[model samples]
Structures are given as structure tokens and as C-alpha cells.
Target: MKDTIEGFLDLVKERNGHEPEFLQAVEEVAETVIPYIVKHDIYYGKNILLRMVEPERLISFRVCWVDDSGEIQVNRGYRIQMNSAIGPYKGGLRFHPTVNASILKFLAFEQVFKNSLTTLPMGGGKGGSDFDPKGKSDNEIMRFCHAFMSELFRHIGPNTDIPAGDIGVGQREIGFLFGMYRKMRNEFTGVLTGKGMTWGGSLIRPEATGYGTVYFAENMLKTKNDSFKGKTIVISGSGNVAQFAAEKSLQLGAKVVTLSDSSGYIYDDEGIDDGKLKFIMTLKNEKRGRISEYVKEYPNAKFTKGKTPWGEACDIALPCATQNELNEDDAKTLLNNGCICVSEGANMPSTKEAIAAFHKAKILFAPGKASNAGGVATSGLEMTQNSLRYKWTREEVDNKLKDIMTDIHKSCIEYGTEEDGYIDYVKGANIAGFVKVADAMLAQGIV
Candidate 1:
């Protein structure tokens, strides 16, 4: 067992090759699961953790599509089905040029435990292409989506593997893919989630991640006799997750003053009202443009290039942009400005040093597995609805989502709450999530 752990460490060191953020993510989960595995007699002569770390299936394909000027372009596509012990693989399909097998593998690996933590009958999988959606015409996006889905359709199904949206892939992309899936298969099943309401998509699906994130934050705040009411919030990213997070924060009376994108962020001290938010949404979602367009659309807004406004001061920070966007430097900035709590809207958005900083500061911190789990949880619900051939009301589904998030928070606190009253959610989530899957695997008598 010791040898396996040592060997696993060596492999990680060799293959992953000293990426600070990646190593930090692995170390957090390893610290929680390895000791527990040693204590249990279930794993003997076999390194389950090491085996689980390796992907069950890693697929990469070539995506060739026509550009606006009728030029054929090629991009890489990938799908990392990390685990499926609980159920068919489920996760998001991101469409960002930064996506590669390593990043998607990490996301899918995290999804395994995150799904288990929710007590949902689902497993982990993640796929996407290196095709950037920005600056592409509608026709270009459609062509790309069709080309990508042509190959992906064979490997996924409602009862097999299901996928939804991530950063670059959203409703538009989902719509295009669903259309193609319908054309190819000639059957309309809930194989893919996040469809428009006019189609097979579930209710409250769009708002699930952001709303769930806030709900988790609220539960964490409940532990400390506080809520988001009348607190100031800063959120990075102007995409679906961040936008919805800001919306829920407003509902809870939080004065949210921040939203950003690749170009930079916009700071509106007066708070983002419904009208202003609608404008911002139009700028990003419809226009497929940058956050700098936000200031042009709305007066009394300031845009700064290559700067995050954490140092300006806030009570909560939501880093929803992408992985490692927030680092030790950002953590220090937030700590110096009196940030109280952080709820991740994007998967693994905060670096390990940043997470440690939160712990050292004794401020509330929720890991992405526990916080940003609403998205996949709702996807599970979508699968249930599809299997049953019945659609649930929006209120019913959203309420279920709320309960799942609350329960996930309880699970985190139950396993993560320290004697010192500082819950190490990283450890708590890893242990809690690992126990269920490990026990299940044991009962099944090894695969």
C-alpha cells in the first residue's frame, strides 16, 4: 500500500510535471482519501485511488469546420469519461481553446466525487473542444457544433452518457447539437441536457449552478449566524454562472458590484440593478462580445484592463471565470480588503494557496465540488425526468436542487467541520464523497 502511494506520487510528479495549481488539487484530494484507504481493509494489493486517478476513457478527435470567409479550420476535441460506477457519465461540455485532456480529466475526476457527495445516482464525465466560441458568426458556430456533434453523438446517450454546457458552450451550442442529434437519430430523447424549455430541457436548469452556489453559501453563512442580506459581493466572470449568482445575491439583498471577462472587469459601486444586469447579459450572451462593451452600454461604469477589483473591498468573492484565475496574490488582495467568504461558481477556480489563505484567515470557504455542484445535480434530475418520461415543474425541480445543495453543505460540515469550528471543506468533501463510492465499489465486489 505504501509502495502504491509512493508510486502514484511518482507518476503524478512525472506526468503532471510540477504545475502548482494542478498539484495542489491532487494533494487536497489525496490527503483526504489516502489515509482513509490505509485504514480500510477493503483495498488490498490494489491501489484503487491510483486506478481511479487514471481516466477510464480518454477520447480526442479532430474538428474541421468552415470559417466565416469559407476557410476550413481544424481544432481538437476531447471527452474524458473519468468514472461511471454510480450511473452513466455526466458533466459539462466546455468549448474553450484552453481545454485539453489534462484539464478535462481533472474536472471529470472531481465530478465523480462531487456527484457522489450529492447522493445523486450519477457518475463523472467531461468533454469539449479547443474551439473558441467568441468572435464567431452564428453560421460558424452552427457549423462547428454540427461537426463536433457528428462524432460525439455515437459515444453519448440519455441512458449512457449525458452532457450539458460549461464556459464556452451554452444554450446556443446545446440547441445546435440537439438539433443535429435529432436529425441523426430521428428520435427525441433527453440524451443531452440544458436544452431550451421549448425542447426537452428541464426547468431551472439554466440557473441551477449559480443559484445552487448561492444556496450553498447561504448554508455556510447560516452556520455563522449571517446571510447574504445587505452584504457586498464581488463576482468574477460575466457568463451564465456569474450572472445567475449575481441575480440570486440580489434576491438575498447582496449589493453585487463586480462582473468580468477575458478583457477585464466592470466595477459599478451603485450595485447592478435588474436593468443594468439585463444590459450586461445582452452584451455578453447575445452580442458575443467583451465586458468592455458593458461600460459602453451603461453609464457610471468603469472598465479596467487586466485588473480584478478584489482589492477594492467586498464581503464575498465568486471566482467563476476559469481554473487558477484566482491565486495567492488574489487571495492576499481579498484578505487585505476584508473578504469574508468565497463560493466557487466555476470548477476549481481558486488555487490551493488561495484556499489555504482562506483557511488561515478562518474565513468561510466552500470547495467547487460542494459549491458549484448545482449544475450537475440538476443534470441528474434531467436524466431522471427523461427516464421516467415525465417533466417536473420548475418550482419542483428548483426546490429539489435547493435541497440537494443544502444537503451537500451538511455533508461537508459533517465531515469537514473541525473541533476548532473551521471546516476544512477540501478534506471534508474528499472524504465524504470517497466513502460512498468506495463502499459501493466494495459491496459490488470489485469491478
Candidate 2:
């Protein structure tokens, strides 16, 4: 079994040796999914996983735009149309300085399983550019988004490929991209999500990913006959995912004590209440300010410069920041501090060693693909709303989102249970998500 796994990984590495992030994602899935394939005769000798690892189409193009200094700038953009067996290609578009083929490929690959777990008709795909949106004027962002979409428009459609926001790409960027798509296609369609609510965007879309992570954690706790009634929670990242996870945890009677960013984490022993959360929404969404500013607004909070909040004691921890932000030492610290539950709000936030540590400790740990799927799931809902030319109320959308998260949790349990009465959610999510796509690929026959 070890040799088989190594051989498979060798093939992948040979093809993607330059892509460390992509290789890491593949290796993680292979560790669990390969064993399942070996046991399931239907999957063995099929090379289905190999086919899934390779993208159906990879589009690359140049994006040129003008900055405030009246200088022309160029950036590379890409879209990995990963798989469309179950439905259309669906994922988010990131605009960060770190965008690359390896990162986008990894994200697109994970999206395949994450979308399948959601039980949505969407498939997996991802696109992005190395363009940084920070410090850019509104006009500059608009120009870049428009240029990016001008090239992207030729390859995507409402029913072909649907893109949403990720990292640097937000509602403002989406608005510009959508505006360009509408002009080029000469029609208003849901080619993109994360739009302003007044313009065909779904309610709770911004909060869905964060809310879903907490909801999954709640379900995990329920299995142990517990709840978040008065638990202390520490969440990393101060963006959309972190803020919303904090909000939902607070609503469920949990004390959210931390929220972090690139600078560092802020620890509020008093807990971030509704007013504080509102301030965060404005700080990040409107003001575009750094998290350090949070200390000035609230004297009770202590800002830890250049450090993660994982060291802070808490009952639950959510890594809502970027990839590989939490490592083995951080996981060990959390375990030592008596933290019992960990849910991911960012893609691949926890390192491989951290995951192994969590598994060894038997803590309830969820990978980002499963825990943070709500963002894409709501994007799926937004796609549905666009097709129907109708909108759902906040209550309606929120209920659906909650139901989907509950169902995803159930799916994880159905496949992830062990003889020792422990739930290896990582294993469960990988296999459960794999089966659906594998079966679809089988039915479709070599596409």
C-alpha cells in the first residue's frame, strides 16, 4: 500500500515538481483516498484519480491596465477548468501577488470535491491573477478587473463557468468584473457571484463561509453531547470568513476572543461583541484599514504583533487566514491548551503536520475543503437565483445555507466514522467527495 501510494505520488510530482502547493494538496488527498480505492474494487485500476488530478482545460492570458500614475501595467491571469462531470465549472477568482498555476490548480482540484460535498450541481474550477488590489485606487482596481474580465469573458458563461470572490477579489472587484462581462456578452447574467445585493447577489453570501465553519463545528460538538453555549473561541484572520465565523459563534453563545491578519492577532479577553464585530466589518469592508487599528478602538484588547492567536487558550480554534498559517507547533499548543475543536475557514490553512497532530490527538478537526465550503455553496445558490431571475430573502437564504452545512456534516459522518467511535472527518470528506465525482466520471465515460 505504501509503495502504491508512493508510485502514484511520484507520477504527480514528476508532472508538478515545480508546484509545491499543488503537490501538497495532491499528497494529502492521496494519503486517504488511495487507501479507499484499494479497498473498493470499482475504483481500483481505473486511474480515475489521475484523471481528476489533471485539469480539463487551463486558460492563460495577459491582462493590461492603467494605474493612477498613468502608467500601463501587465499581469498574468489563469483559469483552471478542473472538472465538469457533475455540472458546470465553478470556483472563485483570486487576485493576489501570490497567484500562480500551482496554487490555482490546487484550489481547483479541491473545489471538485468541495462542490460535490455540497451536493450542488457545480463542478470545480479556479482562476486568478497576480494583481494586488491593496493600496490601489478604485479606478485602478476597476481598470484591472475590467481588463481581466475582457480576457476571461471569452471562456466563461452563466452555464459554462461561474466565478466568485476569493482573497483579494471582493464585491467591489466582482462588480467591475461583472460589469465588463455584461458589456462584452451584451447581457446581464450570473457569470460571477459576490456581487452587491442590489444587483442580483444573494443575501448572506458574504457571511456564508464563516457561518458555515461554525455550524460544522456545532455539529461536531453535538456528536459529543456538547454545544457552543458558553465556549471560548479563538479565530484567526479578520477578513470575511473570520468576521462571520466570529459573529455566528457569538450568536451561539460562544466568546470569540481573537481575530488576526497579516500583521498579527488581537486578543480581546472581554470577547468581541456585536458592536465590535460591526466595527470590524466597517474596518475591513469599508475603511480598508489594518487590524492593528483595532487596538485603538478598544483598549481592552491586546494586539500581538507578528504572532498567531493559536497560542491563546480557547475551547475552539478556527484558522480563517491563508494557507499553511498554522503548523505542528501551533497545533501542539492548541492541544496542550485544552482546545478540543478546530475548523478551517481558509483553504489549506493548517499544515500537513498540524493535521497529523490533530488526528493523533483525536480532536475534531475539519479541512478547509469541507469546513469552508459554504462560500461556494452560497455562490451556487446565487447562481440558482440568477437563473430563476428571482431573489430569496435573508431568512430563506440563511435557512438553506444552514441546511446545506448540516447535510455536508451528515455526509462526512456517513463515510468518516471509525471502529473506535472516532470520526476522521478528513478521511470522510475526501472519500465522500471522491465517490460522487468518481461515479459521475464513470457514468460520463472518459471525459
RMSD of each: 2.1, 0.8
- Scored against the true structure, residue 430 in model 2 reaches a CA lDDT of 94
lDDT of each: 0.85, 0.94
lDDT score at residue 272, model 1, on the 0-100 scale = 91
Clashing pairs in 2: none
Choose the strongest candidate by TM-score.
2
- Tens digit of per-residue lDDT, candidate 1, span 47-140: 6777677677888999999998989999998988887777788888999888887788788888888999889888789999989987888899
Pairs of residues clashing in candidate 1: none
Worst 10 residues of 2 by lDDT: 438-447
lDDT against true structure, model 1: 0.85
Clashes per candidate (backbone, < 3 Å): 0, 0
lDDT of 2 by residue, 310-391 (tens): 9999999999999999999999999999999999999999999999999999999999889999999999999999899999
